[model samples]
Target: MTATSPTPSVVSSVSTLVRSPAPAGLVGHRRAGRSPAPLTTGRARRARRVLAARRRPADRDFRPDIEGLRALAVVAVVVYHAGLALPGGYVGVDVFLVISGFLITRQLLKSVGRGGLRALPTFYGHRVRRLLPAAVVVVLATTVAFRFVGPPLKVRDVATDALFTAFSGLNYRLAWVGTDYQHMGAAASPLQHFWSLAVEEQFYVVWPLVIAVVAVATRRRHLRLVLALLVVGVVAASGWASATLTPANAPWAYFSLHTRAWELGVGALLALAAPRLVALPRRLAGLAAWLGLAAIAVAAVRFTDATPFPGVAAWLPVGGAALVVASGCGPRVGAERLLGEPLVQCLGRVSYSWYLWHWPLLVVAPYALGHALGVGERLAVVWVSLVLAIASFTWVEQPVRLLHWPTWGWIGTGATLGGVVTACSALVMVLGPVTTGTGAAAVLASVDAPGAAAVTVAPAVAGTGPAASAATSAAEQAVARTVAAAVGTVQVPSNLTPLPQDAADSLPPTSRNGCHAGFTAVSQGDCRYGDLTAARTLVLFGDSHAEQWLPALDQLGKAQHWQVVSWTKAACPAARLTVDNPSLGRSYTECDTWRDATVARIGALHPALVVVSQSENVASSSVVPQAFSAATVATVRALRSAGAPRVAYVQDIPTPGTDLPGCVATHLDDVRPCTYDRSAAYRYPDRHAALAPALATASVPVLDPAPWLCTATRCPAVVGNVLVYRNESHLTVPFSRWLAPVLAPVLTTTGA
Candidate 1:
């Protein structure tokens, strides 16, 4: 529920703590069978050779500057997430990917050289211990905190995301949902940051097996060539997929591992090439390091959410990280030296925990504090994240990880831990947002219960009989009177009842069958309802705003012996004009194509009435109103050219900028906070004035039900104990159905 928009998922990382090297012949220097040499003659030289042969360079190669780079990456990520002025701070994830690839590949390559597949268990076990503890703690803490602080609507999603993160499948989950990372909105998941961690975890699982199989089983002479080819294939394939997929499916492209493999592959390439680069003259190496850092800085400053990601544009930061790694492979120089300073290195040590701790803190801070974070509050969140990260790294991540279990023990224990988190998420979903303590059932019953005068219309008579037993218009007005009397200067009962329970269900019936075309739908599909066999048919045409009136139209059609059809798509108006989709970050051409197709279908159906309506908020904003007169006139003329009989236009309802379910849930006792001005409803001149051109040009009569929902005073959140609008723009099915009587008289009088 929290993810209204997409941001990248939180990534978990293994701590790269570089402890100070110990004295000669320390614990790691001597092998099991090796003996230390005494400071004697040829015997001492032989012992020294033995000790040198047995020693592993893994500890000695631990690069503090790499840790500093990590620190910088996480800092960019955290600051960017806090709404700080880093448009390309997300590039930090790219940096982390490169670094992880470089370090992990270096480790795996070394292991394969030394012991081939034999070192795999140790490698995997070390990995499990390195990442599991902090991940578990953060996920569990996030789950618990969200349940307590966030609205119930967000609880299930956060739990599911946490579960996905636990299994390193969050990227897949996000891809499935088509989560748009950039501009995905403010309600993004607290555990959204876990997605990157999933990628790293999966890479950790795979890279070892590939290297072990190639290095241990095959000839050492061919290792570099084999890996180079493999890395190239990964980079080429992933980069191609990223380029192809991003335009149509940004979320999938943004989150999918297949698309991101290239960034990491670039790191592996750099790691393989590091020895060559590090052997370069110190002057060139220093220049390369500085250049890499500068590239990263430029990318962070210049790139934005609009920049197509993980394709060629992403090479800036990824290449930069690789250059820095190559230049610093031997010893710190230039930029590497600056990056290796004590404070930065310390931050690098705790960067993984910082990454884990920062996102959830930022996401839930608003709900916990009951308001959006100000600049000071955002800084406070950053401070708190640092403190928690340092604490967790010092306490949970370090001590427990140092225990070093065997391969099977690690695999078993980690899976069990993941299972526990998964089960917790499942339980949260099963328990749901509407439960006993939440009091949602009681609220639902009150809202669904019969209102004053029992506002129900008699069932539609079969075979062209009179629609309703009673005068439907009279019933509608009577229900309206009952509502007004029931609310004598007090909040309406409808707003308080059935809240946050059937909240998402408030959409029209068209939504159930996907009759309402989504943004990317190329063509409108056929959808029919109500007295299907009737000779006369009524078509509802327009965008989702028009689709919201399905309940009302369905009722009117059935009672009047008319079949009903809806050719509607979300945000696709009948008007043939370009409009900006802020969510898609582009002009919506799919809607235009689908809208034209839908109008053609309406013409083919040639129903008794074609009811048209659309939300006008999508029209481009300017100093003057975008009435869209020419486009509206063209669409109406097209409808006329294709059809016969009456065409009615339904004016759009008011648009409010608040989530009504959340507002109603929070202000259940006092619903006035959720109400909007009746005058403000008609304030938008684009759609309102746009209606005039089409009406005058095509001679279409208008059905204005705005008065029935809102009085002269204000438009209440609910009417007659049945909640009205679903969110801010669309009407609730129950309230829309209740308006059948009001619409019946209009349809009857229109000679349909």
Candidate 2:
């Protein structure tokens, strides 16, 4: 979404627009009473005369066009977040960056001309007054609201995100976590929209300092030229970085100020060239403005979530915004008149507040209402957000901005510091303990829960000797005890394995040690696990689905005395199919390359048995189950051909289709609500429906673990005191470890 902290009266005072321009930073001043006198120092006069000579027939200080652009940008963001049809609507953020760059830089330039950066305190004070208070209010409100609707784990995340947002470092936090998906499998943070505001605030930190340096280093006559060169340098360098990093590192490219500075630089360049731009022919300027609007429209309509953002595609909206601003150098014309309309101007006036309020409502409303919102419901949310935005603007943003206490910037800073402290307190209270508790074995033993033993108790050997029969009976009796223990009213155990807050970090050792490759890495990278010195070798292979099974295999390997070697990569399936990588926003050729190399490597190892598992949900919609089944067959045959004496496909686990940890936390007293229907979990995209029969025909032997993890009709998120799944699909490491005994017999019978 797009957002910029606008000057207090930029659009709110539109009714006061006049032909005679006010002081540079004093346009549309209604609450502040009288406008400041125009800068009249010799240098300021010279600069004014130079600009006045190039001005068009009619020019005014109030830019209704800019205000209208803000409204358009904010509306696009709100619509996009509301799950409307605007896929490319996020470009509005790019437009906002440019606007912020232009306006803030122009103000700084005026200060430089008038008194050599002497108004720095006042400049900073105005910014702090304009942005921080509203941001802090929205962040606090979102965090408190989330505590009730969101699960404790997710609420803790929201609080932590709020803490970062309060200090204008939410962008950095998001960059570190990669949108909380690649690492945690958590829901989108309610405060995620703060990243843009953080970017803008960060820009303010550096841009003004650069202007001061330029003003100090250069003579007054040469100041503009030097600053222009610096702005161009920033644009080119940051633009290149954005394009280069987006392919492999979209989170960093999208959120980092270093990559996004160029959009603001483009605005600064426009402000620097304002005089020459105003001198353009009226007809040409009108055409340029129309073209700019079309460019923004095209980007908004054409882009999708899959687009690698803030790269080359971003130029479309950034340039469009710049052209719009350049056109505003003269009089309103063509599309400018439409942008300057009263309604649009009003939207622009409340745009910052609207942006701050919209995302959290959109994110939190679904859970609060206990259902995904339909279009009508979503539209209702948008309207409610609008009302909140207007209220916030009228009451919070405006009043704080108009308050003129001496050392107000310092007061704002202190208030921001207090907000940060408040957020930290919320974070600590919500997160509670960071412990994952005991392992599954300890938990199952102490709680007398069945765990995998509930299903592993097979029927007694019908024809076996007395000793064998007695052993079977003893096993049956042990399972009986497990059943008895599991029969009581199920409540969340005090010693829950991988406590809710620590669930996401409960990964297997392979993941912790970097054995599983990330998206960019093609090589499997030293992924050997479980008794590396054992004579016989077993290979475990595939994507994160395969990685989830590593804990079981690692435990089984030590018990059975075999070397377990794993080759896993994020989002890369074992099936030989061209798939899309959402993070990279393109075909995962790296997966193909990694698969080819891994298959070759497995062939050379000549493993006794190869175990394969992959999440079926990863394939793009274009990839039919038939094709996926065929690809699975090809992969199995290839593994055998590569000198794997035996190959077995593990039935992928039942996906709960909801955040399991969150659901568990929400229903700590009763986890039945977190259960998913058996048939649905094993349906088409699961690959088991198609691939199981296909593999059976090919004699590859698909081992279904469904019985171990599910009952006949449903799979509970928590099974016998162990949190079975970390997220919707992935197994918690503790649960994986607990399944070792049950999984060992089935895997061993495969004849490794």
Candidate 3:
């Protein structure tokens, strides 16, 4: 879970990527073979005080324990992402925050104590060398890998994320999309890990400027008190805000810098008191370090997804990290010794690179394989990420950071790489969906055309009475045979093409017109189609599944002289029943209200016909068929009593467990791997099954789209060379529109 604020997860991204892990051996070590100057009494004493005043603790007070701490944080994050344990492993990011604050603040105060601000060029150059090279390589490589592993739309989304990663603004992009990282039941952006990095970078960029101003204000006075108060003030206010805001606004509290400022501020304050902390007796310091470690351990194991994040809940980890950092400097205790081991230090050394590499691999691997990762596979993911991290550290990070480049050279390198990343991302956007490989296009051409011979399970012959019922079986069987032959004869495309050409903006026209009443909507409304002026209105109403039929409805209305009105909201169906929506993590009051008002609006319109559909996630009393049936009956009865002359309900299509397009891409050589068992799909409970008896009483017919979507024992991702769905359970407009010839007559049949 990355919000790991409503909670922010661990980082290589936004608030997570705090700084270059300085590592154990890099700090507190002098050039090899140099010896301390021989005793010089009075002259040495004066020089010692001068040097102390001139340098910050970070320059001389480096402890290997901090590196071990970094090791712990990154491991918690990795283990959590791999689904091993630690529901709150995301708090490792909060630990990183404190560590970052301590390091940066100590460095700044050292500069201040030395009688001036650190040279900006030198400071920025160091940061650039330490962080930029590895970041650029990772973002560039992730972008390239995404083109192969993801759907075209996903490729576009990841490209945009790559651009944001280059600029360190991925958190803002995620906020715009209302991304709840903990419950990404669908395809998630791999670069979502970078959101934490963005936050950390933001802190890095702004904190220095503020500290520089404060340093100037103190102007060589005893500035510790003033700085401590400033840090305390931020800690108090930001902590209070996080506690207050998180329940109602978790995403904002999780992602926003302001909400998280207190954790970092507290670490900075600890840095201000570093000398006193170090002055403590060894036994007490050892006790504190062990206790702090215990607190962190408890938090890692006990915290859950529902735990309100980064507010008061954060103190457990944040305070523990601060205590360990403060106490670790005093003595080499058992805790310190354990943390200082070679393996731990090595893990800490490559922690940043590991953080950067793990997330994309975790997100992309399962998608590439078309299945969820097992324990062994998850371990492989971690091992591969570790190998890549080691490569990044050795090849990109160490080599560039060790160089003695001039400040301008560092700046130039950063700018050139940044620009290249931006251009590559922009070029992907410009190129649009990669309409690659003429092979699929050729396979689709012969069978995908609207003019291709139309066939299906037929509708009833229109007549006055019993004869229509008698002829129904023959008509349907003839249509079924025709459809089966035509479908079986056509070549199936090995891979699906993300459709609507503008795949990234594939939302329906109603959504654009603000009438599709998504979960964000406050009220119900209508967006009309076909001949808007036509008197005989045909209304398509329900949740997004109903919206999927819009392409067909619009086509039918234009050709058959019926006006189409859409009344839909995401996740809200016309069935009046209490249901749980996991995405919202609540009863979904907004969806309930939208459905009530939408149905009422439909009644008011008194249209010639009303069509309704919903999702399996929706049910009457519960997620059961019988309950949905009762709910469907009650809803339809109300509509009929409210003057709905005729009504129809649609059964949802088969659920694709994985992203259909991504699956197809992974097995482009053959699509056999993408097919799912039809019996299992059909066995899934249907709301329509319960609705049928109720509808029969009211003369409302049921619409089952199964024949077009599945065969007797198999449900394939593709049919007649057209991709059926873009994701788990929604129809692509192109595929929906292609079904018009089969769906038209059935829709025109007036009665049950």
Candidate 4:
């Protein structure tokens, strides 16, 4: 009896793609018009054929040229990171991504054909063998090296980083931490490359599921549609996210699986559509490949560390990779040819091991040797990395993958990984709290100050508690008593010219209670005894770095008896230009607008003085030069043209350390830790000199307080038991008040 049933052609086609090796004669078959048969068929005979195809020898031999491409990528990345001439070498990662996607997918498709669409466990087992052994060895070595050579803070950081690496969450962790790969800190941790590994693993976990779903739903006919949607969706999403986010947000988008999926997807699409894509002429393919390489190079050179990244800027590398893959002549031209060289291919063959070893060596070598490496030392690090990569790839990676260990080997590997993770976790938990330091003593001391000594001070009778209080009370009582005596003693006949009651009542209500009136009574508030009734009012404006000197201004205002008004915001420097502040939810357009408004308001009041100071923390090579130039010109023109008698520009205070707060924290145990290396602090010698020229051109006098603060030895943190600065750059209130004695002279001379 013959039985007929609907056949599954789709299933048969997939089986053929997976089980059968690419034919050696297929290279010659390229010119032939005969199409390859679909892989799937719902029959016992076809299933047997699929299984038989697996035993056939691979006709298209393994290409060493691909390894050469890998070599080029890693070399470029290593050299670029080491501060060499190859700026655009970072794009090599894109090339690696494409290669990884193609190989992994090809293997998975083959598995699907033999097993009838499900073999996740076996697939993951292969991944474990291929990736885990080398990774485990590298991480273990890095942990030991870091403990000895890294700083205390960095040791703590890298330990946490190691845990993330183990779980394949390193990419997200790095994005959250705002790590800058190019211009890393002196105490930078060694495990940063784990970010890329995390991205790859995440892609692996999801990509198979996606392929499985598409295969089961569409069979073989709609495979191209699924690939197209995935590639387009991921690419568009990444591009959009990149354009909108800040530089700080770029890494999260760039490194995460959700963002980088598109690059891998392109490779997968090319594999599934290889028949059509591979039809291009050899010359055309070569040109496209070279063009891709050029685009990648351009991006690396032009992009700076501060450039907003992983947005539209990422297109150059990702697109270049797609071109190289589609061109199918990576064996012939440009980066491909360069990478295909014997030496280059050898490096490529061991690229994974090389990547794992290089970063840690570069990070730890300088510290183990007790100083940063010069050019020669850097070369030594590169050589050592290459040697280690070779050793690791040969000994650990190769042997582990080739040897088919029993279940016992799996158990042993699992236990070792678990023990390492547990030990690292315990170390971090034990050390985290020990680092906060003893701020309790400082806090207790502050609570014991004289003002806080008596929380419940009895209200003094007629203000006679102390000599200072008595003198202040006497003045208030005299004014009140005089006004009171006038009220009763002068209350005379019908109309004695309406006795100036408003003038009599000008003394505040506090005067009736025998307390000081007006600003003198409100001494705790930032106010002084000044002519509030005066026609002219002067407004002092700037950031806390500027506002710290309020005592100096109060003293000057008191002496001159001029009305001093103030409007200040902490850490908000006045700038003529606007930039987006991700924290504030809008562009900072108001700083300059406020400056103009303040000037106009002051002009309306016809003030004798308009004092402004902004101690901006500007790097030597910044846009500040242009911003400052414009601000200086505008300020000078505004003050001079507005008819104010004087406009004073206070110079910036000295920054105590290269990093202000970190420097303070690092030196908490040191008596003279504030002494920084001047060469490190001053990159632009001309910045200070340039300021003088700009200030000289201004109609206002530029007041420089550097001479008073700096000495030959260094800028001391404490002077006469007073902390010169509470933090890094701002003067403590006590210190600023103490400076009144010295600064009083400068104010007098400048005012004159």
All candidates' TM-scores? 0.83, 0.84, 0.78, 0.62
Better of 1 and 4 by TM-score: 1
Which 10-residue window in model 4 sums to the lowest lDDT?
A: 515-524
TM-score of 4: 0.62
Clashes of 3: 19
Task: Provide the overall lDDT of each model, using Cα atoms, as 2-decimal numbers.
Answer: 0.70, 0.74, 0.70, 0.54
- Worst 10-residue lDDT window for candidate 1 reads 1-10
lDDT of 2: 0.74
Give the alpha carbon lDDT tens digit for every residue of 40-155 in model 2.
69767554444443343222445778888999999988888888878989998999999888888888888754456676777777777777777777877787777767656766
Candidate 4's clash total is 11
What is the C-alpha lDDT profile of model 1 across 154-213, one tens digit per residue?
687688788788779998887665432111233678888888878887777787788877
RMSD from true fold, candidate 4: 18.1
Question: Which has the greatest lDDT?
Answer: 2
Model 4 agreement with the true structure over 1-752: per-residue lDDT tens digits: 10121125423432432343322312331337876566565555444433333222122234344565567678878886677657666767767777677667666666642343466656766777777778877777887676655544455567777888888888887765543211112345688877888888899887777666666777755665775677668757755665665343454665677667666766666666554544454466678877876776776677655445556676787777667666652223454556455556566667898888888888888768978888877877877776677667767887787888754465456557746764774575355422232222221111112221112211111111132232223322322222222222211222211111111222222223322211101121233224565554555655555566765565555656656666444334544444443322234444545556655655665556666676555322555565565665566567556666566666666666433323333344442564543333333445543554575555445555553455322455434333445444556555455444333333344442
Query: Which has the better TM-score: candidate 2, or candidate 3?
Result: 2
